[model samples]
Target: MTKRQQLEMDRGQDGSDSVHPLHNVSSDRSLTVYPRGDGQLVVETETLGHLTPRRTHGTDEGRTDAKLPDRPSVHGLSPDLLVPQPATLEPLDQHIRSHTGYPDIIYQATLIPPANFAMVAPFVYRSSFPLKKNFPFLLKLGIKSILTLILEDYPVQNVKFLRENGIRLFQFGVPGNKEPFVDIPQDMIAAALATLLDRRNHPILIHCNKGKHRTGCLVGCLRRLQHWSLTAIFEEYRTFSAPKSRHMDQQFIELFNMAHVGPLIDTNHLPPWPTLL
Candidate 1:
């Protein structure tokens, strides 16, 4: 016989076998097997009646029945009771009065401003990186294309994201940096301008690593195409790129002649300049 059948025979040994071995156990109690199987042991619990104290009538006439408090229901409990409240901004502002070195601006991830950002025309914006994190902001601006001037390899993830979002990329890879003063190539400038002037590529972004030099040069050339005075163009460039802004960049913009690029459109007849201008 199996071990279970032997256990049953052992339990029925009394011959007055109408009653089970555990039949005398109370209704509100139970037997539970822990660490189940070969080495398992049974645990008996006395619940409700055995756990609660029974009052004797004579001595406990005026006494209240002592019982455990009911557990609070999670479904109806207020969230405030379970979690500590977050600090308020009003307190930070108040603390700023006494705290000398406290920061006035809080930096947030994915919320940093795009480097040297500016709008050159209704459909043309200029900046650095044009990161995937800033893609949502670009989408909000209705930008349809990107004109990248970085000499390095473009990020594959950014390329994939742009393709998925239906944004086109127009790259003009220019080597070297601002310190050594590499000149912006005429061919690259001509190609970028051609892309910019094309209505289908409207709402485009032009960017270099810092958007201060190469991008400034391209936008300055666009200003020349619009017949903007040299002073006005330089002033706009200076506004976007300050302190470390290069004089070579200004010279490049001043010498750029739009007549050589191709036929020019009248500024008044072309779409309005970017609102950010």
Candidate 2:
């Protein structure tokens, strides 16, 4: 076929002359594909989206952009725990002896964090339900308490782990926010906020089924109490519970009576968060 005809066939009905990349070319990476045989020699280029970091909405326009830290503050936690330690294949005793003249004293293990884990404050963390595999990572965080928003009974394994580790469990047990009729309880959320505000509950982990809706609602309210703007609060809520965010939850946050939370907070035991209102 002639070059013009072949080019027309390649461009097809769209009529735009932009050439599609070769099958092997990735849109995200910088790679040049040299032509094979008599094929046209065209260099593949990365898209602008891949080269430049896309700024999140509301970051500009006079709104202060709150970015998540690369490493969140783990107050009172061992610095070593912040960075996961690599497991060594060498025998424990041999490795320990070689390093510090000790025998069988050091055991290296990989820490697997729970799904969707992220720090909400200095010592408060949010995530999906914890499992047996995530126990080591939780332990490393020095978590003293856990707050669960699901209405179901706690898992046996999780209960045992908390009992053995002396980690307190506070279950608020709110129903999921469903459409048409179901709604989250405002009082229960207020109570959970009181629990979160207590300094004694430092290093607490909050979770519900997927750590999205119910958990996001609770965190959204917490942000409100911290005096965050509605735009920032909604942005944070969507950050964790995107693609299926419940408008009901955002409405709940918007209309929530901070007065309910105020009476519940003990003046003497409040956390030292500077932003708390």
Candidate 3:
């Protein structure tokens, strides 16, 4: 399977230049192995052939300044070739803080969670766009997949990190709710919900730019699937998107078409959420 699978929705406007972007989408499912457990990535060292020679002391040989004989060769190759090169001279603290390179400093790393991060269920989490610093915290979660709602190309740094870590990306791009475009396409949300219901995507992280409007809408709809009361759902939604909660997002959750989403779910692999109907 490919590293990233992107599904997008097309806004059927008559070629009008609205602030929000629109693209076409299709309903299709992809599968990949979900790797678990914590294992360190092994970094290979370069073989270095150079060896410093030692001279004998307090002997006739020392007066002549002759070098010591080389160690025995293995398979016609010098044993010194088996020795690895020394590490670079960069400082430890600066390397970890700058995120300029991956070094052994991660052994003593500080894991920093993303903004507005919270656990939605046993294996699911929600957060704002993850930064380089947030990667250590994500590693600890053992994230198997990521579901992103931002309507832009994933960052190169993030894509590289995900590729290196064996995490799959399911990108369903959609614009955030803005005035006059309060309608978030139901088909996109329904498709996203179908993906969320499958246990294969567990240990998933749902995110948008700020984890406020778009993320809140998706989580609210999920609460609806779990048979949560609208009152409670709205309360939780407000907690994350407090100062800038959008009424349109709440409306989308209340009126989300469960009938459209139900048929798309694979009942055999549904998550073990008791309240899921």
Candidate 4:
């Protein structure tokens, strides 16, 4: 096998960071993973790969020099969450704050209820594998009981785990075309929420690889559906994200450039990637 392919396989096993030319994200921050008082694991949001500081180092404790950092700082997406789903920006100690009274915006997946969050698209995203490989630390910090998930073309895997644990996995097939003008598949999104109505108070975590395109489009549509002023929603998602524009992943982006790409619920227009531009 190619050395690059071998390295990727290693990442899949250890879930640690490694130096790779194709990889695009390595956290400058540290990360800590621990069993939370609740069944969910508590992970340090600010640090990416470093384990949460502890007097003793073991399975849950952390170490440094990890190749896969949980999150690379990005715009609108909360590094604090580590998992990179949308939620209200409330704590100064965590991510920067933004407020929208709606409360439905923050969520894990559209298939689940947003815990006190209003659905806004600014936190949505989509990017290809080299980036996913770069952010290796993302694999940690979820309940095995909650099930891991996989999407149609989303490079990551784990849907089976999530479904087995009672986390619902929905499929909104992303078109294979690398074109920039991605139609927001409104029907799929609406149908997903219809399923979530039973769990109106539960939280959902929605993500598509980089959490930029597919996730963003869905969040944007959800915000619009809520009659939210897109402008305000953008402001809130930005406060939490670090923002990286442009990437080398796929082709077919010119159409994305033709459209007015505003922040999800809506704020200032962050420029599209060069391919999209």
lDDT of each: 0.65, 0.76, 0.73, 0.36
> Could you estimate the TM-score for every candidate?
0.54, 0.63, 0.61, 0.31
Specify the highest-TM-score model's number. 2
- Ordered by lDDT, highest first, the candidates read 2, 3, 1, 4
What is residue 198's positional error in candidate 3, in angstroms? 0.8
Question: Tens digit of lDDT per residue, candidate 3, span 6-49?
Answer: 21111233343221211111123221221112211121112243
Report the number of the highest-lDDT candidate: 2
Model 4, stretches more than 4 Å misplaced?
1-157, 176-182, 196-201, 236-277
lDDT of 4 by residue, 83-109 (tens): 423344345433333322224335323
Report the poorest 10 consecutive residues by lDDT, candidate 4: 141-150
Q: Write the per-residue lDDT of candidate 2 for residues 112-202, one digit (tens) a residue.
A: 9988899999999999999999999999999999999999999999999999999999999999888888989899999999999998988
Q: Where is the poorest 10-residue window by lDDT in model 2?
A: 60-69
Candidate 3 steric clashes: 2
Give candidate 1 misplaced runs (Cα > 4 Å): 1-113, 176-181, 263-277
Q: Which residue pairs in model 1 clash with each other?
A: 121-274, 122-274
Preferred candidate (TM-score higher): 1 or 2: 2
